[model samples]
Target: MDDPPRVGSTDVAVLPSDGGTNQPTVTEAPTTPTVTDSPAPTGDRTDPEQVAREFMTTYPRDVRELSDPTFLASLEGVNTALLDQVTDRSLEQAGHDSDETYERYAYTVTGTYQGQVQAFYSMVVARPAEPGEGGGAAENDLPFQVHSFDWAPGMIGDEDRPGPAAGKPVPITTEEREELIGQVRTDVIDPILTFDPDESPEQRQERLDELTVEPSTVTPPMSRSGRYAMIKETLSQTYSTEHGGPITITYAGTWVDPYDPTHNGSWSLTAAMAREDDDGFVVRSVEETAPSEGSG
Candidate 1:
């Protein structure tokens, strides 16, 4: 008997040319090469939803960090100018809160702007005030960065409305206007005019927190030396306060300097107010208006 065919050989029967008996022949078959699939191409970094999600996940919670120039440079395709404007406004409003935790949730591509995808997102952030802190911990809808080439970030105004469209200025009733003005007086004007010579740092911060929606809006006017006794009155309503809009109140005032009476002079200020949840209005920003004509 012929030796058994080798392990990798194919067995075949061959007949001799003289046609006598059939002989078994072993033939080697070509080895088939192994095939493997290469890993799928890495996910497209330019994908719009992917970029937005990555941005939200890695976004800096600290306002100071967001202000860094590198923060915008790290983004792939963002409108730095538009983003900076919105971010600066938002930081001015809520930058001073302590112990902030941001959680990104639902997101959708709203539309395309300037050939770039615009993504609108919703996130729940926990801003927990420190122990003995006046504001306390609250969950509110705040402005967050949106990814787009030309569109600015969408701000969350109310819980019912999820996008930037929610906060458009709406007409306010006469009663509502009076109520808002009262809030500005109690929450903003009074705080600015009142000066405590012996106030502690903690006490001053608590007072500021009580005045504005966030403590960061107004700086505590206190120092070791004598503080200026500010006198503010003659409030003029330059712009109507609308619901879900900004309230601009211009005040004519004078600053009294105890050390140098000559330094005391007439001054004017404009306080910009924003609606804070359902709790009336609160001062969001304060800027010096051009002083009106007056004698020193």
Candidate 2:
């Protein structure tokens, strides 16, 4: 007989304890550890604006800390008691139906290396569950789920076009501009196309048409490594926003259809110092995609 195999998280396993034993020996049964799903967090303020502000402040700090991969990995053994509390409460208040549903709203870094941030924004098309079957919350019923979750540094940011409005015409500060551009090229664009398995030849052509860029002409080649240059060249034009604060800079421009550059689309990019980290800033999140490059 051989040593009994250890049971795993999924199910129990049985094995002989000794090869030479004449009589059958019983091995101690593995005990199942009790795991209680934690409760959610609660906010004291009733105002939505106040809640949003609090969320903006606290989450960013957490994000800043999460930027450190080695430190984050080492914390795997530690219980996320407080973090779970807040996330759970927020989900419950929002009436999210299932943990899986909340996951759709949340983003995760799929793969990363060398301190570069890698991520993907995916569509979570969850249908409403029937009665007696668990389903996502009312809010979860959408064509697509969206959120910006960064796994590593230099993961994502603004396209190379104009800065967000609300600042001087030469909107971005010297230090801030470089950081913002770094993020856009490294973080936001890389992950989306890298994980886009369906973006094959046919899909690439379709993407070209959708993005309104010339097909068959590989200005710099559209591989993941060269996507930043392609995107930068594609979106060189700029626009600005009306409102302003914190000397922030925002820009509005067209998201070109990569497949067909002749077509026009509308898009916007914004840049500002991260409220949590004095040295950092984020591109917020993106909004709708249009057909042409100029306005999309």
Candidate 3:
């Protein structure tokens, strides 16, 4: 008998005929299927995450000319006209950009609007031109973009106008709530309340200069020193004394409805505090509304 066929080799056999010469027959072995890698999934242009990333990368460059139709077109699903309007208003409020060059960005999806994902986009950019050493990105959440609003003021009650979809409630732990309250009191309220009556106008103005960020629309409490003592006394009697007597802090994770012009972005923290005043129970608040540090 022929030697056992080698592995994967065709088998040969001899066929005997009654009166004819023997012929060779060949049998083929089974072939193995070829393997190939499936093509990688293409980045979906409509995917909100993908779009948000692209936006973060491109916005710093595009913001220089926010009204450019070509630039606006790149922002898919955005209201171009409204974007232009807001850009004009923003420029009026914040003034033109200087020499800051944004190189890196981080973003978090906070909510969705009009079926598009909304995010807070933060960037690492050259700090404002300063003497001695250069400044870095603010340690606190001062500068960030509310992607859902297209970095513009969102529509409040204009049902006729296109607006962002209503954001879902963001849940936070009690610890988080307490922490945020502390931050508001420390970063926002303390600076407002800690003023010296003896300080001259120039000294007070210097203090205001330190506290005020560009495009500050909210009237700083330092501007109203007359009420500082009263506000402090009222707060002390209302909230916990150990924590510097913060007001009753009502924290909203995202934006407040009706569109607060004072707030920087939708994701900015807003706290409403109740205090006893001559007008009975009234709301006293200082909206920091900046994103947290290193969040970018």
Candidate 4:
């Protein structure tokens, strides 16, 4: 008869040397090995601010460094298009050369290359962070990724138009705010918006004359104060972050229509007063527009 089939590692059959009987023999089974997986160093970190700051610091100045593995973690949350944007712009500003320092925004050249940047700037803005779900703090809620990345033509610092006002917005009290509103009415809205048209030229002259005297004689607009709010009232600065972009007290308000005083339409006015160190706030400009920019 054919010999008994052999089994794998589990058991072996031994032929009896005495020819008495075929018996099975068992040998020790081989030992199984243990295994463990190691994760990447920065793959598990949760601090978005730290990660972003680090990424900005370590990101390569040379375009070639984009493929470097050392920066993989820092660029974890950034998208390819944004990365490409920065790379392209930086290279353009740096004159297609290597970047040297982030010390003071001169990021186009290092001692390694001949580069100088006079009119280029790059900015990174991150969105505000919020807490994760389940109430308690968690990494998922933090603004762990860049929200906006842009390359402007010139450097933007506190010294610029809006930059100058960036010097700690000056806080004003409720009384001061009211006073500003009153000033806005007397100096701004009353002149262009409050005019009756039917009133005699002398009356208009009187109104204009009143403006010359201190404590402005013009009766402030009735609903102007309540209707209009300071554009930068809460910003804590004399200047508003509006298009004009200066240290100016600016406001917009509506007045009851003289023609349609009952309930038809109203006059909308936007006024601005500049802030000078010596003169303080002065109404220097005013413009009238349709009720709203759009007809609707």
Clashes of each: 0, 47, 4, 7
Q: Alpha carbon lDDT of residue 249, candidate 4?
A: 38
**Maximum-TM-score candidate:** 1
lDDT by residue for model 2 over 73-100, one digit each (tens)? 2122222222322221121111112332
Give the lowest summed-lDDT range of ten residues in model 2: 18-27
Name the lDDT of candidate 2: 0.26
lDDT of 3: 0.28
TM-score of each: 0.33, 0.22, 0.20, 0.27
Count of backbone collisions within predicted model 2: 47
Q: Report the poorest 10 consecutive residues by lDDT, candidate 1.
A: 19-28
- 1-296: candidate 3 lDDT, tens digit per residue: 12222222322111111110011110011112222332232364322233334444444345422111212222332223322222211111111122232211212223334454433212111111232234444322223221111122233223376333212111121122224345554554455445566776676555544332221223332222243322222122112212223224433222211232232222232333332211111123335544322121
lDDT of 1 by residue, 104-210 (tens): 21122243334444433221111112323343334232323221111123433346654443333222222233244555655566675567767766787676654
For candidate 4, lDDT tens digit of each residue in 1-296?
Answer: 22222222212111111100011110011112122222223542243324334445444332222211211222222223222223222221111111121011111211111133232222121222334565433343433322212222222233345221122212221123324555555554446345353566577555554332122233323323233221211112122324323223334444342333442233343444433222124444444444422122
lDDT winner among the candidates? 1
TM-score of 4: 0.27
| Deviation of model 2 at 237, angstroms | 6.1
Sliding window of 10 residues with minimal summed lDDT for model 3 = 19-28
Backbone clashes (count) for model 3:
4
Residue 164 CA displacement from its true place in model 4, Å: 22
